[model samples]
Target chain A: MTTKTPEQINEDLLRPLEGTSPRYLAALTFFVLVVLAGAAAFLHQVYAGLGVTGLNRPVFWGFYITDFVFWIGLSHAGTLISAILRLSNATWRRPVTRCAEVITVFALSIGAMFPVVHLGRPWLAFWLFPYPSERGIWPNIRSPLLWDFFAINTYLLGSVTFLVLPILPDMALVRDRTTGWKKKLYHVLSLGWTGTPRQWSRLEMAMRIMAVAVIPVAVSVHSIVSWDFAMAPVPGWHSTIFAPYFVCGAIFSGIAALIIAMALLRKFLHLEDYLLRIHFENLGKLLLVMSLLWFYFVFAERLTTWYGNGSSEMAVFWPTQSGSYAPLFWAMVVCNFVIPFPILAIKKLRTIAGTVVASIGVVIGMWLERFLIIVPSLSHKYLPYSYGSYRPSFTEIIITVATFAGLAMLYMLFSKIIPIISVWELKAGEVTETATAPALARPEQVRAD
Target chain B: MASVNSIYGLFADPDAADRGVNALRHAGVAQDQIVVMSSEPHEGHAFSLLDHKTIMPWLAALGGVVGGACGFLLARYTQVAYPEPLITGGMPLVAPFPSAIVTYELTMMGAVITTVVTLLITARLLKWKQPLYDSEISYGKILVGVLGPSGAARTDLENRLRSAGAEKIKTTGQL
Candidate 1:
């Protein structure tokens, strides 16, 4: 096959989103309003101290911390799918990398803010930094909290770098295609790229380095986040398996978020041809593998705790399985483990609709999983007399809604600015095919003749 | 040293430059007598025809060891220097679990940073004075280089490249 003309490729890549449908616009407006409301509530919390939220003495971290973990966990999908897949040369990752990376950048920003939000004195949160303050004390490096500061910062920098590097070539393409301020913006961002052999080699090399580099950072970041809880002396929290458990769960929820993102972008951007059914099928396979792994971790964790039958561990386990939070606990198991196992297991049901449904279940189940991890331990501390149930207030709910809205808004804005799919990588793949196909086809031609 | 009798040079797209080197070997060029030079670093697989091997992975491994050591020091030495006099349940002041966290973080950070730095150094990047091939190669092309006898050998190499779908060919000075 002859190479498609640049004009045809440009048309294929930049087909304008069918002007935002009324329903879509209305939904977006509603989310924006909800986000504003949440922001207002957050402002109230900041002004009035965390006192405005339902977080009390025992339940110092409630929705905000859970959301923090959730958001950070969501960030893993991009690096995992994009960088990891790229290194392995998984061609299927081509369509999903941009959205995944964008989700990562946004999710990291959002997740990074929660620690600040959780701080009672938000203004004094700078105290976490290891600077010479009015107090002569440095942050205790021994503390997991301090480790979180390093881990999150490293993760954020790595994720941002990972996101921006690949986008440079795509930005150049966008600059070439568009006009007016967007073109100027793209031009300024594209760094005077002329597609020289040296530049391409360097670019590809940088991308390869980044892809290989980001995977471990991504894994370690979430593992450290899990350590924030697990390293605590609290009985239920002091499990060695927490690291892998958290990592698997992060990947699970991250993939689910990616699925939802792909579906939305596919619908909104009309990217069905580029992000085809096969991509979804591949993602479904990943989800199934992760689902089984997550289930295994969960089972191993429970069986160990149950077999040990330690009083404090059992105390936490009982509430999780059959006590006050049993409904949430069981629902988490069904959603995260049970539902995904079968739906993703069957090949016939691993289509777009099935994967999407399974993804939704995963998102819900993972959220519930966070809730299960958090509330149970806090509700069952060593001294039984001190343990108490946590109930989140309306303010907390509003802020949660706002944070999600903010994430969506950031994603929407990103799409409008840069392509949701990497135009350059797609083009590069196309060019590779064009370059190689003639050589590949000659044997066939000779055979045919 | 024997007077360098021949100034050998050839230009190619990166892929052709790569394949040309291998073809050079088949055409009776020795590993030491030939060099592949290009506008950028080509794949190591292409350099299999050469005498010197790439040193990137060795540097990466060294970085990993240093990083893991640093992590160990961070995890183990904290208690030693500060002396947390109070002990909890006789757990060693330097816990293995938390130490593993540090080890993992530092090891990965080291490996990644080293890999990046090695690539940059090997590719000879960020130098303002480096020469370049045509800009179009950046738009999805490759460049290959071979150094040997300039006249007949270069022509034969050019013919080989053209047959392999190389769009253009040129020769430069000694390197």
Candidate 2:
């Protein structure tokens, strides 16, 4: 990657928004079709009832719950990790933070939809809130479901703030450079930022406070998500280790998703200079650590369950170990640990291609892990007569596929509106070390927008 | 807010901007009267007034306290205050563990929401017009605007800016 002047950087970053291409329109059309298909499937499920899903008595929860967990875990990719890196003074985070922060906001929004989608009466989802109505009742505050409701919404709000606050200056820059409707929209989004000292000061302070404050909220979110299963009395579901295990898995999957998003943005947006090989190398190392930690967690969990030797637990466990779920079980292991461990553990193979491949595997593997955690236990319960199998119906399958498409669509649209790579931050990074250099002194070289 | 006559200087050099700030101070411009506008945050620069003190920490704390209290009360009152208690598995109505979970989440919500609100107000955002704004700052120029300058002081400040390598000086929003 080569160093770029602020002018070149501005031109490169803004190039995506200069005009829409036929290819972009085609891609957007494809994603919109998928979203519409998912909406249609959801309508079918709603009209026909939850019976339209593959949900059965023993295996009541299936793909939707897994997707909820998966999307929620993916949300961890951005804001939490970016916040941590920012607070730790990780300078390399500059190019990556905006991309990651955007993921958090979108993924959280997508993830929060599952609970509603899975509900028998999606319209009554508001009952989850603490609002007292004519029925004169509040939501059960003791339930972990309510806890998740509060946690996810709070996280969504904070993530949006975290994502939008730093982008204000960039938006103002865009506002100054653009014309017509887009310029008008930028005016509102930029919040009248003029790069004044006090504005930047308070913005930085607010970001700091949010950065410090959002960590525990992020941590608690996944933990509470874990508690959704852990609080249950079912054999495999009830575990004290669920909180940390789920949190680790979330961050693990989150980093993988971020790497994938970065790679995609790099290729499509022509940000080769900005999103450099060094970024992939560093994030690959982080992903490698997370992979090891994830392996430790899985090993510890299985070992404890095996040693405890409770019949109910073993009944839930054996299928995952050597029974029906063994294939998905091992596939998950390969995708998450076996494949990624070697690829990421070695430096030469940790190239952009290598990391992307590992990330793809991790994404698939994490989805499987969520599925395996939810379904198998629910399937092979202690009561042998009640033991049942699940295969997702067309409705569930279509909607699940659509949600993935929805995410892709949302991300693509977002990049078109705002530069996927933050322009100002990248420019700042260039001048940070050489602020007094003659190159900076001659700001007249900067192109007039 | 008291209306003050604004004198603006545009510089290409960060060092020039720094020196220009000093000259303004020498010319009797108060620290609060001077504003530095740039495309990037200059956190440690002497001219970077953005490193000024903020009350975000205290506000976050206050918000957390209030939010946590609400969380606790919401949990307690919802479970115990109803005409009929909603209990699970014969457990106590107002379980401390369950209550603490919601308390922790809502407390964080309070802190973040408070921090965001404080940020908006203190940053003086959403205003129709901002003081001393110029499109040139977006094009990599650094702006130093001193408010409340008189005829002679303004000219002296402009001359000081000229010596410090300002590309141009203007009072009517020209960069």
The DockQ scores of all candidates, in the order shown, are 0.10, 0.44
Residue A418 alpha-carbon offset, candidate 1, angstroms: 1.2
Evaluated at residue A117, the lDDT of candidate 2 is 97
Worst 10 residues of 2 chain B by lDDT: B42-51
- Per-model TM-score on C-alpha atoms: 0.77, 0.95
Candidate 2: tens digits of C-alpha lDDT, residues A341-446: 9999999999999999999999999999999999998997788889899999999889999988998999999998888887777776666544442222112222
Docking class of 1: incorrect
How good is the docking of model 1, as DockQ? 0.10
Over 4 Å off, model 1 = A1-6, A16-30, A132-136, A431-449, B1-175
True contacts kept of each: 0.07, 0.59
Which regions of candidate 2 fall more than 4 Å away from where they truly are?
Answer: A434-449, B1-5, B173-175
